[model samples]
Target: MQTEKVVNYIVHWLKDYATQARVNGFVIGISGGIDSAVTSTLCAKTGLDVLCIEMPIHQAESHVTRAQEHIKQLKEKFDTVSDTRSDLTPVFEAFKNEVFFDGDQATVDMALANTRARLRMTTLYYYAGLYKLLVAGTGNKVEDFGVGFYTKYGDGGVDLSPIADLVKSEVYELGDFLKVPESIMNAAPSDGLFGDARSDEDQIGASYPELEWAMKMDEAGKRAEDFTGREQIAFNIYKRFNTANKHKMIPIPICEIPSNLL
Candidate 1:
């Protein structure tokens, strides 16, 4: 892809969309991941007010450091860029106290992790409403469309997605062109929802590159039987996520009323 052209296109798209919507600018959660770094940079290039928020809930040190580094770089590079930090650890703990823990350990843990994402989403939207800024999504093609690896109405909740069309590799290319912090470019991709340093691959059981390959295969109508060994395992992993998380990828289903009934 023409990296420069792609960057310009996204910047223009963002500016145009915000202009049409009459929003002042954008607000995004900075997770220190490649997707957020690239996305925040793209928004900064739009020459509109961009707020980078850090909402951490038991987040790992490395992730926090990288997020801070990236935001600092963005503020230095773009006059319209600004940042704020909100420690959601206490809020998460309070929420856990109010909720029941009747489920198994793994199940409860998963739900709580998703809660972290939802909290951050709420935080971003709060700022967006206060500042009249649009909530900019940081999801990429593989995570947003291919694997559906995001929390519904959580991180998936956004006013617009600037990088959803670009795959992980393509996002990295944009990151390079945008001069994102080196620490982020070298860091492992993660959701940071679990409050640990475990990478996204560790949770999904497949790396971005592997998932990207599997996504292409599935789109080309290839089945698991077509591959063997590691390839088959990766393909199956991709399919399982794509199928289970399909709800996040599509619009919510609605019951249509029959016109005759009225």
Candidate 2:
């Protein structure tokens, strides 16, 4: 896909959505990642007011620095781009101290990480409400649909998802065309949720390229048994992730009654 065309399409889509919804602009959580960087740049390109919030809670210093740099570049390019830095560490610590309970360390850790995402979501909505802006999401196709990698009701909660159809590699392509900072473009992709700074690959057990390939193969009705070595491993990982996170990707299930009864 041509980056320029994709950029133009998303910008126009955002404009149309906001205008029809009677919203002033977009509010996005700038996570210092390529997805957020690309999404924010696209939002700014719409020439509408954009509030890029950097809500850091025990975030990696490198992530924070990259986020600041990206926002600075955005402000320089677009007058409509404005930003706010929110320190959410105290908020997270208070929640942990007051709400967390003893359990499996891994489970507790995952919950805390999710809490961080939810906090960021809340902060975005708070600004959205105050400014009458829609909360723009930054998730891409691979993470959002291929593996359902986002936190449910956390990062997954948003008024709109602009790049949910593009794959991870395609996001990088868009980022390059948008002239996102090289520092962010070259950095490893991390959710910045675990506090230990683990890359998404470290948690997902497969790189974006591998995952993308796996998704393609699966969609084409290829079986893991037909592949060997790393291909097989990638297929297996993809299947496991997609199955485990299907609940997150699919809509809520509801019971239906027979119309005759009514």
Q: Give the runs in model 1 whose Cα sits over 4 Å from its true position.
A: none
Q: For candidate 2, what is the lDDT?
A: 0.94
lDDT by residue (79-186, candidate 2, tens digit) is 999999899999999888788478899888888899999999999999999999999999999999999999999999999999999999999999999999999999
TM-score of every model versus the real structure: 0.98, 0.97
Report every candidate's CA lDDT: 0.94, 0.94
The clash number for model 1 is: 0
Q: State model 1's lDDT.
A: 0.94
TM-score of 1: 0.98
- Native-to-model Cα distance after best TM-score fit, residue 184 in candidate 2, in Å: 0.5
lDDT of 2 at 9: 96
lDDT of 1 by residue, 1-262 (tens): 9999999999999999999999999999999899999999999999999999999899999998999999988888999999999999999999999988987999999999989999999999999999999999999999999999999889999999999999999999998988888899999999998888999999999999999999999999999999999999999999999999998888899999999988
Highest TM-score: give the candidate number: 1
Residue 117, candidate 1: C-alpha displacement in angstroms: 0.7
